[model samples]
Each structure stands twice: as C-alpha cells, then as structure tokens.
Target: MESTTADWVSETRFGKWFLSTETWYREVLSVALREMREIAGPSMPPIRRLLDVGCGQGRSFELLAERFRPREIVAVDIDPLMVRIARDTAGRCAVPVTVMQGSVKKLDLADGSVDAIVCHQLIHHCSQQAQVLSELFRVLAPGGMLLLGESCEEFIDTWSVRWFFRHPPGVQHSADEYVRMVRDAGFGVAPRDIRTSTPWWSLWEFGILRRYGLVRSPLPVTELLLLARKS
Candidate 1:
C-alpha cells in the first residue's frame, strides 16, 4: 500500500478490481493489442523480450505472449498490491514471466534492454508523463515497437469515470496531444500508425445511457491507440 516517490497515482479500489474482470480483457486490453498489431502490420520487428509497463494484475501477459510470442515478459506495476497479484497472474502464463513493482518514471531496466514495450492505459495516471515516455524510449531496443493505448481527456474527464477511477488531473491529454507527446519522446509515429476510437465502453455515463438508447452526445475521439517504433 506504500506509494512511490514518483508522481504516479495508484488505481482506486474499484479501478483495480475492474482490471481483473473479463470486461477489461475483452473490451480494452485485447482490443488495443489487436489494433496495434494491425497498425504495426509488417513493420513490427521480431520481439524476443517485451516489457509491460504499468502491467496491472498481469492481465496482458498471456495475450502478449500469444500475440508477440516473446521469449520472456518483464512486467512492472507501480503499486505493490498489483505487483503481488500480477506475480500470481505471471505464473499462469506459458512464457517466462518476471513481475516487479517499480515506477516507470525511473525504470530499473538497462538501456535498450527490451525488444518491445506494451504500455496501455497507463500514461494518464502519471503526472510525469514525459519522463515516463523517456524511460520507455530508453529501454526499448532500436527498431523495437511500443504499443501505446490511452483514454483521451474527453473520456477521462467524464463524471462517471472521475468518480470511480483515479488519475493525475492536470496531465490528461487529447488524442492529438497524446500523439504529439509520443512523437516528441523520440518514437517514430506516423499518421497511419495512429488510431482513434470511441468504443461504446468509453461513452459518457460509462455507456449505461447509451446501452439503453437514451442519450447521445457528439461522439468525440475517446481513445488513442498507436504503434511507435524506436528510430
């Protein structure tokens, strides 16, 4: 339960529990990975080692293994509680899994240590977003891919989400800004490599009213998905 000195916000209790649900795996994690795979197309290099930054509950382990078929997975979460649960999840995977509790702002990884990085739905929780991105760029091998996914400011500012989840307030970004941030961090992200989605789950009222066909706001881009490669 102890927090790190880094400018990171640990997930709320509801947020943490939701991460273990089938809904998260199916709707969020799997979808993002699949989209990034499509975005990468033939450009994605052979991935031998992958680093899963902000790997909550290790939910992405099996999917990362099955999709990328990496030789090893190194997963880290800032929260110690999530790390313990993720360690259990890691053991269930077919691939070699290493779970650690650490902040992404200052990763323990050596420079150019990983062939790929899966950093999904993590940046908004970080106030030190640029520093975190810098570390991601640092540990990734040249030509390695970064599968980055995030909820844009439009989605993160929704009342339902604001009530249930925790995030660094001032650092929330729009889809374009998120794209620019990654580009500024030294990753090579082209326009074709970026994807914007407004999944039903990201709808206002957490899609409850939308599911009932009661209300509709001007649908803005709520999610940003991209495949950035180290140059």
Candidate 2:
C-alpha cells in the first residue's frame, strides 16, 4: 500500500550505508536499546507483538528478540531497498517477523494492534512528526509502551550530519520538545520515563576533545530516549 503522506525524507547514500554498518549496530542501535530498556525499568510491558518503525536493514530484530522476547515482530520502513534487505534479516531472527514497506505517518496495521513500538532515530527525517506520533498512538494498544529514541535538534542540526544526511528541513526539535511532542500525542511521558544524553558519537569530533578533558562543560543533549505509555 502507498503511504498517504509524503512528509518523509529518503536517507542519503551515506546514511543508508551507515545503517548497515557494525558501528551502527554496536554503538548506536545497541546503546539506544540498552538505555531505553534501563529507563523502562521493571514495570515495562509484556510485548506480545512489537512494531519496529523504520527498521533499517532489521538490525534491531535480534536485539528486540533478546531483550523483549516478543511472540511476533512487525517491522516497517519507507525505503523499499531497506524493506527488502530487512526481510532477509528478519528471516534470521528467532521471533516471527513481518517486514513491510510503508510510512509511519499512516501505518497499515489495525488500531490498538501492537503491544509495543520501537521508534528509534526516526523522527529527525520526517516532516510530519506529530502525525507520525499520532499514528503510532493509534496503533498501540492501551497500556502499551513506545520506546522512542531520537537524535535531538542539537545533533541533527550540526554541519557534519546535515552534510551527510537528508532530513526534512526545519523539523528538528530539542530533547524537551520531543518529550512534549509525545505527551501531546496522547502518550503518558512521566519525568522519570525520559533520558537525555550527549553520546560520544553525537559529538562533531566524536568526543575526542571531551575524552581528553579539553571540553569540560556539559554539552547540549543530543540524544533523547524515552518510554511513553499509552493510556
């Protein structure tokens, strides 16, 4: 099915290639999952069916299975190439996975169909961020959880990222704004549910100066990881 909205940006060649890299799997994806799970705490929901939005190359599949052990997984991405490649990756996952090519602005799934969702590093590329969140809220079951991970405006607005990636212009948001956006979309985002950080990879210099103690000041939060639950 065709996406009802065209408010999405295609990943640049470098961005697409980066998604498949070991660095992405280890440093970015794995770290995000670990942190999100930590923030979710002991009350994290039982995920019978999980929806992974923007499941690039399906790298999160095995991690999701290991972390949540969901009975089934539904992975969606706007890129057909990623979708096709992700299908191959999905086949290797222990959990049953269905990878589909579609936009999160309008998921083809039924209302309240999923127990959990992983929207990792996806909002920065979409113009209709609110619409995407609303769609996610609609598809999620009541009491379901949404693990939302994002590179906040501080990181996405940088020259290196701008030059190497293709994002919808003027749509980036700060960490606080991101939390508010999810809350405004009908999810419950308690203060304790939020996590913000400036990871080494998010730094323009890859945190070299910070590692050497040349940069002592705390940096603006470049990462936003949260667990918002539908009520």
Candidate 3:
C-alpha cells in the first residue's frame, strides 16, 4: 500500500498513546534505553549535541537525558504533528531539547556536528533506508556513534503483527543485511546483542550501530545492537 508520511505518523497508535501517557512511555521504552546504555558503557563521555532521528514524541530523548546528561539534544521527524508533540514532551523534561519537523533522508544539521545519532524504531519506517543511512553518516562526526533499534526480519513470520506492519514504510532487514548497510555507510560494527526483551509473544530486534570498529562478534544475532564509529 502507498503510505504517505502523514499516514505513517498520524496512524501510529503507539506514538499517539505514548505522547498521551507517562507510564506507558516509561514502561515500554525504558528497557531499550537501559540496554543501550549498558552496551554504550558508563565511562564514555557524556553525550553532547545528540541527534535523535525520527524521534516520535521524544520519549527516548527523555530517557537518555536522565542517564547521559547531554548538553544539547535534537529530535527530528517527518511529521509536523509528531514534532509538535515531541517539542511539548521535551519541554516537560528536565533538559532542553530541540524538535524539528524533517525527514531522516534529509536532516537539517551541519556535517560532523553531532556526537551521537540515534534512530530507534525509525529506520523501518523509511522507504529509502539506504539514503537515510547515508544522511546519518554524513552528519555524524568522525568519532561519533549510531544507535539503531529496529524490528527483526523475523517479525514478518507472525500473521497478526505482519498485518499491523504490512505497509511500505515498514521495512525489516535480516541481521546480515543490516550489518552490510552499516558498513557500506562507512561505519564499522561494534559490540551488539539481539534478544527478545518484550513480554509479548512478538519478536523484536534492537542494536547500536557505531561509526568506528571497537568490538566484533561472530555470534548469531536476530536483533542487532551495533556500535559503529566513523573512520
């Protein structure tokens, strides 16, 4: 089906519901954030000038602020409504964050300006995933990091979940394909893990893709947690 940007953003029940409630936002997204931090390591410099691509309602930014204490946080989304809601939600948080209404395929940021770029559950929504990855690579600094959390290719096997995501914007990739994409974008793979964290019977994948090569593993991973650094 042809999915417009509006249809993808406005029709997302989870995003709308997340913007409306604090509890659901905290409960559902916190696990991913915690795991990201654990993999990112505590000794890393406090993330400054961070960019969250496709940040719906800025929930992840809210969680990241409490743990990492970034100096500047920017959240971008293609939908104006999502950006508006994200700005409002960020306003309620302890730290200041900027929300922009823009597409990940074309971000409004200077080259090598951001220290970290995060695209959580957002890559799947892009029809031009490679273009988006290129843009992400372009805006990140040499030592910057890229964190991606996405649905696994295995998710399509389930009939119920498949129906919910049976749209053009919903694209799932296998672990090997994702790794190749990250490397092709000029980043090396780092430490990552793919495991089921949700209580639901559904399968999901989460990973941190970095800009540099720090750690590598041949272990089979369903949902990737990659950390790639720019070379």
Candidate 4:
C-alpha cells in the first residue's frame, strides 16, 4: 500500500507512547495477553516459532517470549523507528527477538513457517485488511493459530461513535464480519469476551478460531476477541 512520510510518523508517535508509558500499554495489552494465554491454555506445547505482526516496539513479543519461551520470535512493523526501538528493547530485555521493517500485508517470511501469529491493534491501520489476512494465512502452518485483537466495528453503529473512530483514523470491523472472514479463510471460531480493568476505555474481546471445524455460540456483545487457525 502507498504510505507517506506523515503516515509513518503518525504510526511512530502512537508506538512511542505505547512503549514509553507503562500504564497505557499495560492497561490494554495486559488484557489481550491474558486472553491469548487463556486460549492457548497452560498445557499447550511450547511455541517454537512465532510471529508478531505490526509488533511496535516488540512489547507484545517480549511478553510472549517470557511466557511461551519460543525459540525464535519475529516482529515486523512498517515504521523504521518502531523497528529500531523494538530491536533495542529486545536487546535490553535479553529476549531473542528479530525485528523487521516491513508491512504485514507483504511479509518476507516463507509459507507455513510459523506456529503462532499474533497481531494487536495493527489491522485498523492497514489499507488492505483482506490482503493482509491472506498473507497471514499463507505464512501460517497448518493448525497454526492466528490471534487478532482490534477495535470493534460495532463501535460505529451510531454517528457519534463513528465520529470518534474517524478522528482516530482506525478501520473498524464488526465482530461478525471478522468471524466470517476468518471462517472463509478456513478457520474455526472460538468465543470469548474482551474485558479490561478499566471500564471506560476498555476495548477487549477474546475469541479463538481454529482451522478445524469447531464452532461455538455467538457472542451478544459489540466488541469481541477473535482467534482463528489455519488448516
């Protein structure tokens, strides 16, 4: 996709704030991470290879590395500054993390190479969400998990809500739409709620979708967490 220098800077500013402030980052990311772990389950095998798309500053991968003990973690982002900061953070944390400066829609990795792929709040920024999803599916191994967390499209049902989303310039998708897309890409959907310690700004949902044909009851809430696996 075509991106201007300003777009890169805007993304960088957002990433900087997230990495610099513990409160803002933890408040949201912590919930997402917890939900992901729950879906993964404690008995799940150790993740040998993992990818964090739009890995801004590599904070999420850092958390995952500590928990899953993945042998190798690749973090990719479009912004060079974000990639640099992520590399530095990995160095400081002593986590074996590899940061790449590139777009998720066009990954440099080989097909079916990763066991798990995690993307947090980065889909809203992409102009080609479908293409990005396709690329994600292509790179994922059969039975590999794809966890995505982002703003709920239901937030735009009203004009006031739509205004808020537009001001921030995020591409929102309804929970149902997300599930449908994942299913179309050959995944099973897992149901879960996305909650946070903070109420007002809480935008969290946890759903697990697998490549298998397992299906769960639909959620009634507006926001959701989606988990899908590639078959």
Best by lDDT: 2
Model 4, span 1-231: residue lDDT tens: 223542332433443564567774676677777787777776766677889998877777667877667788888998777788788877855457788888787899999999998887776666567777889999988888888776565443446544333223444566667667667776666665233121234322223231132534443345456678776
lDDT of 4 at 107: 91
- What are the per-residue Cα lDDT tens digits for candidate 2 across 55-85? 9899999999998879999999998888989
Compare candidates 1 and 4 on lDDT and give the better one.
Answer: 1
How well is each residue in 1-231 modelled by candidate 1, as lDDT tens digits?
Answer: 745354877677888889989999998999998887788686556788999999999989998898888999999888988999999999999999999888898889899999999999999989988888999999999989899999999989988899999887888999999988898999999888888989988875666787677876667999999889898
Alpha-carbon RMSD, each predicted model: 1.7, 2.4, 8.1, 8.5
Encode model 3's per-residue lDDT on 16-111: one tens digit a residue. Answer: 554557654654467666767776776766677888888877778778787667887988987777777788888887778988887888888989
Give every collision pair in model 1: none
Off by over 4 Å in 3: 1-15, 18-27, 169-171, 191-222
lDDT of 1: 0.89
Q: List candidate 2 stretches off by more than 4 Å.
A: 1-5, 213-217
Greater-TM-score candidate between 1 and 4: 1
Give me the runs in candidate 1 sitting further than 4 Å from their true place: 2-6, 206-216
lDDT of each: 0.89, 0.90, 0.68, 0.67
TM-scores, all models, native as reference: 0.94, 0.95, 0.79, 0.76
Model 1 TM-score relative to the real fold: 0.94
User: Local error of candidate 3 at 99, Å?
Assistant: 0.3
